[model samples]
Target: MARLNFVLLIAVVFSALYLVRTQYESRRLYVELEKASAQSRKLTTEKERLQVEKRAEATPLKIEKLARDRLQMRTTTPAITQYVEYKTAPAVQKASHE
Candidate 1:
């Protein structure tokens, strides 16, 4: 009867230890999930800000300003424009003697 009681005590201690370990793992996972959610919110806000900037830049007036100022491009009068093309000479045939 004493040996049976000792076995029961050991089983109860091991069961308690298992329960503690399981709870610890669950708490750790919960903390990690909270951190990931916070990071996701931060990235979502940044994406929205970038989208607003993109929309502002896509305006036609902004594009024209960038093209004229940065690229130095201007609308040319038809009389100021000229087209030229170069023609290549034909290749000469080589004679081979056997």
Candidate 2:
């Protein structure tokens, strides 16, 4: 009977230790999950902000302004327009001396 009591005490102690370890691991994982979710939310907000700015920059007025200011381009009038065709040259072979 004394031996049985000793064995039961050992079993109970091991069970308690296992439970404590499992609970600690669960808490740690929960905290990590919360942090990852917060980061996802922050990145999603930043993506939305960048999308809004992209739309504004793609407007026709903005395109015209960029072309005129950066490229120094102007719309051509009908009187000054000319069209050119691409010309191809024939290949010539060089004479080699033996």
Candidate 3:
């Protein structure tokens, strides 16, 4: 009867240790989950800020300024315009039909 009592005591100790390990693992996983959620929130906020900057950068006046300053471009005026004319040869058209 003492041997049976000793076995039961050992079993209880093992059960308590197992419960402690399970609780530790659960708490660790919860901490990791919270960290990941916080990181996601930070990244989302950064993305929104970048999107706002992108929108501001895409305004037409800024594009025009960038074009004029960076690309040395200007609005078209007839004084600086050139015209082109296209005339297809009759010989080339006849060959394509064959």
- TM-score of each candidate? 0.73, 0.75, 0.82
Q: Write the per-residue lDDT of candidate 3 for residues 26-78, one digit (tens) a residue.
A: 99999999999999999999999999999999999999999999999999999
- Candidate 2, residue 9: CA error in Å? 1.4
lDDT, candidate 1, 23-89, per-residue tens: 9999999999999999999999999999999999999999999999999988789898998999989
Off by over 4 Å in 3: 91-98
Looking at model 2, the pairs that clash are none
Best by TM-score: 3
TM-score of candidate 1 versus the correct structure, residues matched by position: 0.73
Could you give candidate 2's per-residue lDDT for residues 1-98 as a string of tens digits? 99999999999999999999999999999999999999999999999999999999999999999999999989899888998999889879888987
Candidate 2 deviant stretches above 4 angstroms: 84-98
Q: What ranking of all candidate models by TM-score puts the best one first?
A: 3, 2, 1
Model 1 poorest 10 in a row by lDDT: 89-98
As a TM-score, model 3 comes out at: 0.82
Error of 3 at 54 (Å): 0.3
RMSD of each: 3.6, 4.8, 3.3
lDDT of 3 at 86: 97
